[model samples]
Structure formats: structure tokens, C-alpha cells
Target: MEFPDDLKYSREHEWVLVEGKVATVGISAFAESQLGDVVFVELPGTGDSVTKDEAMGVVESVKAVSDVYSPISGTVLEVNDDLPDNTELVNDDPYGDGWMVKIEMSDPSELEDLMDAEEYQAFIAEAES
Candidate 1:
């Protein structure tokens, strides 16, 4: 329900924040709500290689477990080291400190395949209805 205008979105419900060669990735607010309270996170370590749209990790919540997908092909530079102990951040600040991974992109142009906030909002609306 809260889609920030500056970020790009994947149809799979991931949000991407890019700065030069690095991309920060996370699930959208809508996704956290859908998943209920998050209980655990399984993430790839730094230096792991992940492809765009691939299941890179998992988030387990009260409602259901879900895969966290990469929005771009990249090697992970960092993971939110705070996440395994602070699952609440995923719901508290999904767009900020709650970010999952920082990736050094293998192809920055792949970002163009994603949707902007406005487009993502419309996409969510249609998916929900």
C-alpha cells in the first residue's frame, strides 16, 4: 500500500534502489503485510552471485514463507547483517534500514525492465482486485 516514488519495482513484489553500480533490494510494504509477521530470514552471504528474478533467499512469516528474489543480476556486496535478529525492520522500514541486499550489478540496463512507483501501484491494484 505504500509505494515510494523513487524506487523501481519487480512484478514479483521486490523493490530496487540503485546507486551507480549497486542496487539495494527488498520486498515492498504490500508484501510484508501479505506475509504477516516475519519470524526468520535466510539470505545469501556477501560475494554470492545472484541472477535477476532468481530466488536468492527466503523470508518466513506467521502467514507463509516466501522467496526473496533478485531484481537485477549481480554479485552481492552486502546483506543486511541486522536482519536475522531484527525481522521487524522488514515491516517497520521496508524502504530504509529494512533493505535485504546490496548488489554490484552485472547488467545495469536490466533495471529498465522494472516498473516505477506509479506503474507498480497500478500493477498492485490490478493484482489485488
Candidate 2:
């Protein structure tokens, strides 16, 4: 239920923290809670080109599997390998250590299209109800 104001969100429940042309991505705290205990994280490789709104990877929780979507078009620059071995980090620190990938956004303007914290929270509320 915690959605930080500084980040952008995808409808798919992914959040992006932009820093210059690079952005860090992770699922929202709401998403992790819904997924239950995360067991496996299928990460995309470095240098992989990703399109906006497309699935970049997947997170498999004890309850179900969920696709991780890219909030911005970019080339994946880094992945948190530790996540695959210790998926609970996602639940423990979704905004920091739980970050799934770092991407060099191909078009920064696309960031303007993503939802802000308030909008995303509203989206979550609507989805839940």
C-alpha cells in the first residue's frame, strides 16, 4: 500500500525511479504483498532491449506468477542477481535492494506517460475494489 511520490508507475504494478537517463525498476509494495512469498525471480540479461509496457521478466511467488513490465523503453543495464537466490528481499526492501533492474531509457519522454504515486494508488484502489 506504500507508493512513494518520487517514482513513476506502470499499470502492470512496476515502479520506475529515474536517475538521469537510467532508471531503476521494481514491483510496488502492493504487488509484493499480493504475490505472497516470492520464491523465484526470472531476470532479464544485461544489454537486452526492452519495450515499454512489455514484460521484461517474471516474479514467481508461492501464490502465483506475475510478469514484470518495463515502464520505459530501454536496454537493460543491470539485474539484481541476488534476487533469484533470495527473493524475499523484494518483500523486505522493494524500493531499494528489491529493485529488479537498471535500464538506460531510450526515450526519456516516455516517462511523462507513467502514473505518479497518487494516481497509482488510486489505480490500486480501483483494482482491489
Candidate 3:
């Protein structure tokens, strides 16, 4: 499992990539692996307000249906329209094209609550044990 150092991770297994005030959100590779094959994705509409640590969307896999949480408070700027039509991308490129949404942050401070790649690696390691 490779946790890219450029991203921040939530304990719920969501990853965040922030540029300016916009954040791109997605499930980490580890989360996708645990979910098995992704069959469906339900994303919040553009302009929807999302609270930190709350369920903003869902990913359904062959194993289970899981909530995809928002790591920061924000208004959704965009959703990956390709997901509903091509769910396999979530498994094939979790860090790239598999990204779910872009959020215009309401509070950048909320990022402080998330873990960096190194910390997230340790977190999942502890979880697996």
C-alpha cells in the first residue's frame, strides 16, 4: 500500500488534496482495497454544503456499502461525473482519476485534524494489527 506524502488522510479513510481553498477528496487506496470491487458511487451535488467528519457520499462495493466522509467543512464545487458510469476507476486509480469531489473550504483549520501520509500509514498499521 502506498500512501502519497502529498495528501492528508482522515481516520475514516478519506484522503484530501488541498490547493488554495479547494480540496479534492477521495478514498485512499487502503480503503478501496478493503471495500473490494466498487460497484456504485453516490456523490453530493455541486454546491451542496458538507460538514466536517460527516457523510458526504457513499461507495458501494461487493463486500459492503460505506459512507465517504468529508474531512473538512466546505461547499462541494464539483463531483466526478465519471464515477457512476465507471466505478472500476475507484479500484484502479484511487489516488488519481478515482477522486470523488472538489470542495471549496469553509474552514481550512479543519485540515489540522487530519493525518499526513506518514501518520496515516501508522494508523492503518495499528488498525490491521
Which number leads on TM-score? 3
**Evaluation by TM-score, superior candidate among 1 and 3:** 3
lDDT of 3 by residue, 36-103 (tens): 99999999999999999999999999879999999999899999999999999999999999999999
**Reference-based TM-score, model 1:** 0.98
- On a 0 to 100 scale, what is the lDDT of residue 61 in model 1? 96
Using lDDT as the measure, name the better of candidate 1 and candidate 2.
Answer: 1
Q: Candidate 1 — which pairs collide?
A: none
List the candidate 3 regions with Cα displacement exceeding 4 Å.
none
TM-scores for candidates 1 onward, in order: 0.98, 0.97, 0.99
Residue-wise lDDT of candidate 1 within 8-123, one digit each (tens)?
99998999998999999999999998898888988999999999999999999987999998999989999999999999999888899889999999999999999999999899
Which candidate number has the best lDDT?
A: 3
Each model's C-alpha lDDT?
0.94, 0.92, 0.96
For residue 11, what is the lDDT in candidate 1? 93
Name the runs in model 2 displaced over 4 angstroms. none
- Which regions of candidate 1 are displaced past 4 Å? none
